[model samples]
Target: MTILDRLTGFANPAAALRRAVQLFDSGRPSEAFPLMAMAARAGIADAEYRVGRCYLEGSGVPPSRVEGTRWLGRAAKRGSADAQALLAALYVSGLATSEAVKGPASQRLFEQDTLGEPDFVAARELATKAAEAGSATGQAVLGYILTRGPGPMRDADAAHRWYERSAAAGCAEGRLGLALSLARQGGLAERDRIADEVRRAADAGLPTAIYLFAIFTEHGLGVAGDLAAAARLYQAAAEQGLPSAQFRLGLAMIEGSLGDLDPVAGEAWMRRAALAGNVEAAYLLGERNVKYRPPDYAEAATWYRRAAEAGHQAAARALGSLYLTGNGVARDEQEGTRWLRTAATSGNQAAQVDMANLALQGIGEADDTTNVAGWFEAAASSGDLIAAFNLGLCFVKGVGVPRDEGQAAQWLRRAAEGVAEAQYMYARILRDGRGVAADAQQARAWFAQAADGGILDARVALAEMLLNGRGGDRSPEAAVQLFERAAAAGHVGAMFALGALHSSGQGLPIDQVAAQKWFSAAAECGHGQAQLMLGRYLAKGLAGERDPLASRLWLERAAAHGIVEADEEFAEATSG
Candidate 1:
């Protein structure tokens, strides 16, 4: 095309650029693009920036990052503030695209024409220069870099300041950033301001702002809750390729919050979000696959692995479990341990307990017992009751450290808040004054709790305390009931205690026959005291007709079990 036709008779490059901007403002990018390109070729910096944006977004031409970046570089080199800000943003985002040109030539082009490959340092440098030159877009980009770019560069206060400046300058992205900052501060006034800023930014067509506004509407944050309106806004942002928005819409559809339950469509949206690198979507897909009626274990493993590779701790733990059990992948202890360790090291409490158990079983590494205790402590610090109980045992028994009953009591007491076994152990500590002052009342209380949890030992201990009134008011009736219950469950101690209670008439009417029956039952189960008592009962005909042979036999058994008095009794029975 002739220059006159291309530029529309505007000999001045600035004049052509102004006409192109007017046309673009009127939504005639196709007509404006050629004129903008003409002005760019004539070395107009602002026109070069406009042409670059057009190429980048494919406003009036096919999208090409290579050409777009080239034009942006030209404009940036000529001191175009807008070009500098946009180029910085692209570099910071790694120019995300599967279609990005690659190879040595592409690398050279990126290095020479676009600063470098995803270099945050260079991005920050360009954004700083542009922001200092008073570009609203530059200020917004700089604010983003300060807010979420890198750990070392993050400065929330500084980011808020930059966002405020850019928002005052009328940048929609800046308004969105300012709203996010205000949301974090979290007050009635801040929420109201956030609502206003987010709405304005959404009106300006910012996808992230639309997504935020939708969340606010859905949850009634400084706005009336409206599911339908939130769903519509989610649809708009999702269609714009916002992964979080897509995930939200997917959840809404799956939960029937979008008028109908559409699992197929919901899952499709989730898959799209996952493919777009949404880690939570990937993790959720893995969970769904595993929870299906006929679980797709192989597919679950695949999805879990994807999220795990992206540093999702729950996904790593799930993938590790599958690998360890051979549920989806081949059983690979080394591989499973590696993944479990990955999550454990990242502060996943359950994963830490898993690793400790594996070590205890000698299933993974041949680590010393101390390593197991260390893992338990790590999880215990995060309020894991099982880990706390385990760590307490470790301290009490010196299995993995120096025996320290005081430390054991501390941990076990904390664990006792929820763990039945810990309650039982803590009760023992209280009863014996092992690590703290002996408190019979506390011991009885904890034993009762553990007994209710089905602990046989705790039932016996609590029954004894009740019968003796060691902790509170004596309740022989309650004691007898507890003993009977434990005896039914095959506890030898409870059976022997029941025999004593019957013999003493403590909880029921005195009955020699019942005593003899209970003593014989406990004796048969290897209770030495019960054996001796049973022998005496049989010899004296305490419950029925005497049987000398049975008495001698019982006495002999008790003697063999280390009951000193039974030896003399056995000799007497044999003589008789």
Candidate 2:
């Protein structure tokens, strides 16, 4: 039933292992696996290592780390340097063991036989032993540990030495590591050396090397820029299960940067990368689901949760927002707060602001002014203008901190450079000499900027300044234009100003009829001064036909509004 079933029996395990090596080298892994298993059962260390590799890679069997680790562990105990080095590599790559690996419970006879977490200390010891035994892969593993392992283990010079030794022994991973190290130095000679070494490693079929070479080609880093060639190399590495390469190829295809838009293939590749544990790919998938029309919010949440669990700050923020709003997920205030706090603690400015607002409004937490101000300060210090503006208001109103006019002015001034509300507030501070020297010119300038930004209150203030010549030269015409613009936007004070301007002929020819019309408009908007003036005008019939009843009604309305002058007008109209 198998290749080994019809073959003559090998004389010994050594002979069988030799034949298996030859068959495997010739690309007949299926035929080699039978012999390898036979040799492994006879306790041949190299055969055990090979069988383990076959299981891990699914070369002649379904991939199973639990089975692979069992074989590798046996060979390692038998002092097989290659097996020790391979186990070290697997541990470093987070593939040594996992609870996800499937097998019969009966198969897990020992603790180590079960797929469990990797142990870095054991990985380092195994790699050191194999390296001392002159295994090139072991040397490469040491280089990787020194270069990318935990903080205390990293040593750039030591990594370079290990990589150099491993490369001399002809390890593809060593060549790739050495090339990447040389690339960091950056020069023509280093560039050429890096390219040559990467090319050799890629030729040896190292997926990471191929991916790095593709990046070089794409960016013209150490080779001539060629997008087509880079795309081909990306595809090659992606097909070989390189998550980074898959991500790059997917992005390129999705954006049509490779001259062929294949959204179906691109999305499939993206999903593959995400499934392969590419955090950025997962986040990108979440963004795609959320940003498109008819958004699949549930799918977005799934991707976002994956990325967030892997420590993606933006994904955490987005997922938190979804939970808070019950979008695609049930509204869970506690869960939302937890995720948002994670994002905020990770230095996400927007999350900090969101958290602050939630605290202020008692949405997910009790209202805490101090906590709100602390969050605002954190975001404001990081250059969030909206937070800076809020912080300024907090200082001005003593909402969270003691009201300090000086601090308020300082914060408001920073926000005023971009925020219209802050500009208006800052201008008012300058005009009133609040915690600063009174500078009408500066106030007017800021008011003009705020007005241009569509602050109606700023427009009215600027118009008044122009009419009174408080900041610079008087310009009645400019004042009248500003007042009219504000009036059109429904500013009651602007209407009253227009009425007074027309009555006094300060900006235009005296037109009592026009004055009366503006007064009536302002009075309707509850301008008490406008009501009193309109009442007087009606009582004397200064602008139009006298109507005693109308004059009495206007005067009574003005008096009710607390305009003392309206009392005289009411008595005059009643007596007439």
Candidate 3:
């Protein structure tokens, strides 16, 4: 038989409890639970506390907070310091069941407050009793109550004295409490001392202390920034079953906040944390799955719905959009809009921007320019870049606001802080002196920014400016490269620019073949001038064998496009 199986058959409850403590300490709590319960049933105080802890945390048993509280109460009445400390915390937080906290009727706050309307008087009595009995946790908790003024008891000076005594007793919670209090009072040197105390508690393996230390390390607050160290601490805390730490570690991996991204590891951690009831982790899992290779929209919907039901506003918006587009579910625009409205009302900025877009496109039941502008304004105020851009356009076109160039420029400037397209728009206004002062140098800077951001129009515009010596220093070679980039991205104007540059040998050796190729590309895109030029090149055999039929065809096409010279050339080519 396994040790636990043998231990369960032992006649002596004391022996069973001893074996359970060994197993539990070795991280095999499942093997320890039955033994602990057996001893607890025989009235062993230590076993009772251990059993209560297991039930409270679902460590090795199905969690039952009520049962946990009952066992803890039994242990506390038997004078177990740990049990009294824990039971006092539950009462103070009002997390104990009504049956467990059923003191005299005078102590019952029957009304349901968010924290279940805990009986603070009872909590104080238990904490005071435990402290008087020399429980370090009890003393530290009593200090916390004083700080937070649980049930009209406020004594900061006494709280400080209690925390000092608890810390002297080697309690990590006491050290953590002192550290938090010191952080509020001290200058930089005091903050540094507080950090040392926090580190001490963390070294003692306090999960909350470790998690806070990780935050301090990651942000360089009162310590040198050490992302690697922060990640290690977070991992340690997560292993201790801290859901928030698990969520943090997952986000760090997914976003590469510490090092190279590891989406697989990130997703695994996120899934675990989500199952542990982390709404943010659930939302991130939905986002990741929605954009994963080949996508798992059904899985995305499931997670999003789960998080949304738990008050994750972004997940609500994502789920609504999925339903609207039928991405992973049936298309039900009415239902989708209802969810969207829910998210918007809950203050999700993206949802507000989405509502603005629907009104702008006249897609909603009450679509109107006024509603569109109002939603856009709300979203913009909440710092949404696209909403700011749309609001700028509305101001410029008087769509939902009076035409105000100054206001348009202001909003456009905010939008321009975000993306390539907005940068290009702002550059256009600067270049043309429209609704803003014309500053050729400033325009060039914005165009360069937009071009570097991979905007084809911005690339072509920047190239033209460089070639013409208008906005910046003239550099024909740079202009040629910019034109080539835009042309590769399928801009017909860029093709024409490349053809002209190659024909004229502005920054490169004359290459008739390259010139003809670029001219042909532009001509096929219905550029009349390019067709006429391509026709001339074909007729002249500039790059290869003459093709009379091809030349005549191009000339006729250009003439049809209103190129007068191409009409004359067409007449000449066909007249023979």
Candidate 4:
């Protein structure tokens, strides 16, 4: 028989519904809708259910939730299995209720008081009716709700039975629900099997199933880690314009573990997802642009604004940073502080640290040590290295906290593990025996490490220690070598040290001409000591002819750089 003849021959409403299901399954929901609607109007319960589904999901027409609900209610009243199941699921999920619905009101009657009550009994009744029918989707939905025991409904055994029945019907969602239940029961092997079955169903083109499968693969919950596969599946779903899938795909691409790193592409996908109302994608895109130097700051600011509108704490913090730094926007410290406070109160670590700094510096208002300390504490607790270093400084300086050497050392140690500044400070503490046992060798080692990591102060401290034999045996020649290396890298202290050594004939043969040249270079680099020494050489005509005017200029600049000796020498030179 032809397909149409077979469908016409079926007098059973259920059979007619099955024909419509076959049409829907064949990607002809448009054709199936009219037939389903006609059958529903003719008192065919299953047809009523299918028509409701088409309207509810907008598969073949403009969506009409009211019409869908009316048809589903009619089918449910007529004992249509699928319709009853869908209604049960909706009620259990609280999706059937209006968003403005409130809990039952409390009342007092003649001194007896009644508390507000949940409408769980109504939900349970719907779920029970659906579970009694041979609807696997209904069974799974009811099982999930009952197992959670939300409100007054609590029946683990019934949940387990329904889940098992649903699984037997080849329902992928049912299998996943059963797997979760098995996992809770410590049945790892069975849980894995069920999870695998769900994955297979997902591979067979179930939209929700594909999403769950991608999640499992991404997290390696039931399968080996397969981020590439997860990304592919997410991309597929995203191409279909699923907002959640778009966000997931964008995130994976941005992170670059699943495929070739493509920040621009990731940002593009995230932008699309954000426009689709994915708040997380908006937040992530905003953060990436703010921290990673995106090509367009205005676009990034727009995304940040969207996320902030959606109440994303990190995005608010990022927006604040842009405003504070005048990055892609005009500087506005007050607006920046306002946004930072919002994020800081929401426990955003970066915002907390920034808020602390702003408070300490009185950036937008009067300085508040108490508030600054609180923000620093919050940021430090969240593992912010800068905050930890600042906390250590506060302890050492008695800024906001009482001067406690032990606490200073503790916080410094934490920061020292990550920050060059903190490392230098901690190394100084070791060298000076401040709140800790003196360890010269340890101090030298840390200083060297910090210097190598580009801490200018650490480089100077290490060079000084070597020259003066503070932490190790004296090595004037080695100190000169260190100074030369640092000086070549534009370290002002190193340049001054090199110039002094040359002028005093301490490490190598004294060459007056060479000394003059080294001092000139150092002075040009703003080395105050070099400027003063060079000025004296010029005034005395030691390296060349006397040039009083040039000598005075060097002395004046040296004095401006806080050279006390230069001030005295400049006065003497001016008088002469």
Give the alpha-carbon lDDT of every model: 0.87, 0.86, 0.84, 0.76
TM-score of each: 0.70, 0.79, 0.55, 0.63
Candidate 1 lDDT tens digits, 1-576: 346645462567787788888888998888888889889989999988988899889998777677787788888889999989998888788872222332222553443333334657667877888999999999999998888877898889998999999999999999998998887776577887899899999999999999999999999998999989999999999999999999989988888885678999999988888888999999999999999999999999989998999999999999999999998899999899989988888877788788877876777765535677888998888888999999998898775679999999999999999999999999999999998999999999999999999999999999999999998999988998999999999999999998988898888898999999999999999999999999999999989769888889999999998888999999987886
Per-residue alpha-carbon lDDT of candidate 3 for residues 1-576, written as tens digits (9 for 90 to 100): 276556563678898888888888899988889889889989999988999899889998977666777788888889988888888888878887546544432343343324466666667777877887899999988888877755469787888888888888989989998888777666476867778888989999999899999998999878899999999999999889888999999899989997769978977888888988899999989988888899999999999998999988999999999999999999988878777777877877788788767766666665445666777888888888888998887887886678888788788889989867888888888898888899888888889999999899999989888988887679888999999989988999999988988898987789989999999999999999899999999998998858889999999999998889999999998996
Across 1-576, the per-residue lDDT of candidate 4 in tens digits comes to 246634663555555566667778999887667667657777877777777788779987666555665677778888877777777666555545422122121221122222233335555666678778678887887887788756457677778888889888987667767766776777566756756866866765666567767887888877877888888888877887888888877777777967888877887888899999999899877667656644567767888889887889988998888888887788888888888888887877778788877766757554546666677877787788889998888888786678988888888889988888889999999999898998888898889888888887788888888888887898888777778888787887787777677777887677778778788888998878889988998989888768889999999999998899889989988897
Candidate 1 Cα errors over 4 Å, as ranges: 1-71, 96-120, 128-136, 146-170, 181-187, 190-193, 220-224, 257-259, 324-326, 360-363, 366-385, 437-449, 460-487, 492-576
Q: Rank the candidates by lDDT, best first.
A: 1, 2, 3, 4
Predicted model with the maximum TM-score:
2
Q: Provide the global lDDT of candidate 1 against the true structure.
A: 0.87
Alpha-carbon deviation at 486 in model 4, angstroms: 2.9
Better of 2 and 4 by TM-score: 2
* Top lDDT model: 1
Q: Write the per-residue lDDT of candidate 2 for residues 1-576, one digit (tens) a residue.
A: 154542532557777888878878998888888888888988989898999899879987777677887788778879999999999888887776533223443565343533345556677888888988999999899888888888898888988888899999999989998997786656467887898899889999999999988988888977899999999999999999999999999999999886589988998999999999999999999999998799888999999999999999999999999999898899888899889988987888788788877765666555445666777898888788889998888888776689899999998999998999999999999999998899999999999999999999999999999999999999988999999999999999999888888899988789999999999999998888888888888878989767778878889999998777798778776786
TM-score of 1: 0.70
Candidate 3, pairs of clashing residues: none
lDDT of 2: 0.86
The order by descending TM-score is 2, 1, 4, 3
